[model samples]
Target: MSRLLDEEGLPPGMLAPLDEDPGPARRLSRQKSAALVQAAVLAALDAPSPPPRSRRRHEWLMGGALLVVGAAAVATWHLSRRSDSLAPVETPVVAVPAVVEPVRPEPVVPAVDSERAEVAGVMRTGAEAGGDVERAEVAGVGVMRTGAEVGVARAEPDVAGVGMKQTTTGGTEVGVPRTTPDVAVPSPSAKLRGTEMLPSAPAPEDLLRRANGHRATGQWKAAEALYLRVIRTDPQAMSAYVARVASGSLRLEHLGDARGALRQYQEAQRGWPGGVLEEEASHGVTEALRALGDRDGEARALESFLARHPDSPHGVAARTRLREISGR
Candidate 1:
């Protein structure tokens, strides 16, 4: 094949190289290339390959976990701090019932001992005061007298023949029998029968409650009577003002007794002058007069109320009523 290639004018080496051994330079070059490829492969394996997508994702996940752990720790610490800051509430102690003991009776003194003690005290007092004290038997009973008493009795002449009896005890009464008494003693039964028990007066609050009950039950007469009684019983009391107003209202609305209502309103105004009920009483008076067809009286009452209490709670109503009654 080489002879044929030379005859065709081909390069003799190109044809001959194919059948020859490789040169040292070519072998060196191939070895160097193989070394470079091995180095590149080792570098790709050992020298930090571009961080893996999984590694970055793991870093992010780890960071998020660290943040979550930090937040949880902070939250736990904050909760613990808050719990420590709060004070513990103290519970109230209940009192136990005390044990009760039975009452003891007082000791009684003997009559003889009491009498002897009294006699001894009297004798001691007589001796200290330089007075003579003597005990003698008179009419089969023991008697005692002082020296001053004996002298006074001897100086005075006794008109009656009644004998005197003395007792050693100080508590014993000296009974002097009288021939006649001015006042007669009443028998026990007669005394007991003569004991007159007055009826108890009703309380103001009770009367008000009863009156309100009756009013609620539509018992106007009974309610009015109770209200009147409360007003009459305690006119100076605050409840009386309420009763008077209630009575006036009952008379005006339920009974249609305008004159009686007007009287009650007037009395309430007099009893509670410039008081909390004054405006109400004045208004009630005007309303009662209006109900009775007394236009001039209504007008006058309204004018008085408006003048006295221009800034009263019912001032507007009073002014309006006055205007209506005055035909203005």
Candidate 2:
């Protein structure tokens, strides 16, 4: 093959046998090429390999998880901020001062007239006695004196006076009995019959009128007594209602007895509920509560009064008092 190659103009060493020893320079070149190829192979083995499809999928999932965590944190922060903004704000409390009312002076009652009261008392007694007593009126001083007594012995008594003498003393007659068979003692049935003929008690209307007269004259005790009599006589009468209300007013204003006045007013209200004078009684209840220093009760009473009597004459005052009690 070598002889053939030489004939074809090929190099002589190119056709050397495979078993023949190469020269040092050729061997060195061959060694260098082998070393370069090994180095390339080692570099290829040492370099990092690309991840597999499954590993790449896991990495993507981790990245997505990280992104989701960041988004969740951001969303939590936004939601917390929104909640803080939407939270209710506390309001500061302010104290209000109480309203005070001015004090007023008490009313003064007029002095009682003695002579007029005396004459009134005498006339009242004579009228109540049912025409049994004789009253003599002195002209200038207006004084009254009792002239005679009823159911007394007379001079010509006991069957036309069998020897009876009439004795007169100080322009008055005195009866004396002598020891005689014709003079007879009076029995107890005769006295009882005489007592039975007297008149009954006065009417409630008359008693109320008399009480009003006494109250006007400043005879407070007498007026109160007569009013009580009227009330006791006829509790359901209109005159009794008037008497109770008047007595309440008298006790509250003139007598300065608030408790007594309250009783009278309450009794009138109970006796005559929803009557013509109900508004007056309700108003009086408020006044009584006010006088007793019961602020809450007074407020309630005033409210009730306004509700019941919206167009009452005292509506303005009732509203004013209610506002005062409520500290408005």
Candidate 3:
């Protein structure tokens, strides 16, 4: 009865029939749900909450990392600076050694042409003899000579090539007295048999006079040769400078030989370096090179002339030529 009252005590019709009392299964399900709830509550209460994140500790960690990065960057900068300090410095100036030139010895002068002077004197006498110089014997200096003794004979061409006429017979080649027969001329040594019997050496003045006379007489070849002879015999002679310049002029003006003119001027320079005619010689060299189509040679010659004779008479001309060559 007690069990009935405890559980099934309530009859369906008893007290308005307690609505369908749950069966044992239903009771068991309720007990199980309550136990699950109790367990969930216990678990919720027992689990330790995650420790609150420490803001100070986070800041410390971030600061440490930043410090390490900063240290690495500073060390890199310091190493770069050290490397730069250890590097070699560049200098603006590069030093080069100076060069020394070798010294050259002075040139020796050439010997004088005494023999040429003697021959010129003889030729002068022959010209004076009206081309009637037959043969001559050399006596002592200032001594007398025979009238028949001649060195050379003067002949005039005959009409229609008939026969030649000698000048010794008073302007007539026909038979005349004092006209000597043509014969083998005596050797120069034979003529000078007597000790220095040849007339006194002709002065430089005399040679220059004869040369001038030849030039005036339209004897261009003879005049040029005579002038050259005077120069060769004695470059230091009073008129040698004039003779050299004149010779070069004749070659250029009359002979049309620029090369020959060039040589004449060069000889003057060689005979008398830094002399009065050096400027002229330099000018001549330039002109000759130009004639030969050697532009480089002409330029060099002009430059050398200017360097040596800056104040020379030809200086202006030389400078002009240099400008032309250099396209200034």
Candidate 4:
């Protein structure tokens, strides 16, 4: 083979062929095997051996390993999904209802009657002002007289700054003064202007405004305080005193103060003797006294006031009330 190989020489390529040649079948010659037991291997040459496992076994092992890994991944995914499905549900956040504080509505103070309104205007003009101490004392004494029995009428001052005897109209009435004398009075509009637009005093509307504001704003204590201050400053403060009387009288179930306020109205009647307000005060006294469980006293006052002031605007109303009281 060496001689035959020498005859063919070598092939033409970048790499020179080895001196030994491995044919298509990697087999040794007879002399190279049994006969070649004694043969010498000049160059060490080797051929690859067959695989240890069969091809079918290798394919089955790879396929089984892939199937196991796929099954494990699918099992893990399924377990995770099951865990998620069974997980506790999240509760929706329910916004707690905002605790709304209730807004208390303001109190309703009755509109000051026009008669009281006019008297309030006169009072604002400082009608018959006295020393503060004397005015306060007079007001206090009037309040104290309610619980006491009827006694001698206290001495009061006439509008002329002179002391006058307080008479109780014991005889035929001398009649009420509703209209001023024609010579002393201005025109209708002028008289109204004189009464309403007092340049020398604060407007009665201003006092009414304050009283209404205090009452409407649910400020009972504040309203009471303002009423008291106004009545004290001007003892003839008709609307303010009347408003206080009304306010005090309304709480009759809780505060039985109508009698005290009724006495105050009586004092105001004396302080401002000759206006439509006097009749109104008398009526207010009648109503308040009746509320105080003294219907008889109320009836007598109403009769006296009505008998004295037949032409008063409220005269008809007073008569109606008297009739009702008499029937009762």
Evaluate all candidate structures by whole-model CA lDDT and list the values in order.
0.52, 0.51, 0.49, 0.42
What 10-residue stretch in candidate 1 is worst by lDDT?
166-175
lDDT of 4 at 76: 57
Runs of candidate 3 with Cα error greater than 4 angstroms are: 1-197, 214-219, 235-241
For residues 1-328, write the lDDT of model 2, one tens digit per residue.
4335344643323343443233222322222333444444443455333544555566556556655665665555555557657763531212111111111111111112343355456544443333211211111222221111111221211111123121110100001111221223222233234332224555444455555556546787787777666565545667567667777766666677666777777777877898666777777778777777888988998999899987565787889989988987
In model 4, the worst 10-residue window by lDDT is 168-177
Tell me the alpha-carbon RMSD of every candidate. 60.1, 59.8, 60.7, 52.2
Put down candidate 3 lDDT per residue, 86-121, tens digits, no spaces: 763532112211110111111111111243344445
Pairs of colliding residues, candidate 2:
none
lDDT of 4 by residue, 1-328 (tens): 3346355643232243342323234433222232222111211123122342454365456556655665665555555557657763532212111111111111111122343355445444332332234323333222211111111121111111123322111100111111211122212232224343334443332343444455445554554455454444344445433443433432232234565656556665656666444555666677667777787898898888888766554566778888988984
Q: Per TM-score, what order, best first?
A: 2, 1, 3, 4
lDDT of 1 at 102: 12
As a whole number from 0 to 100, the lDDT of residue 313 in candidate 2 is 52
Arranged by lDDT with the best first, the candidates are: 1, 2, 3, 4
Per-prediction TM-score: 0.38, 0.39, 0.37, 0.32
lDDT of 1 by residue, 1-328 (tens): 3345444653222233332233323322232333444444444554443544655566556556655665665555555556656743431212111111111111112433464466556444433332111211112222332222211110111122223221000000111112221123221222223233123444455556656657556787887777766555545567666777777777777787888878777876776787655766777887888888988988888888788876554676778777776887
Q: By TM-score, how accurate is candidate 4?
A: 0.32
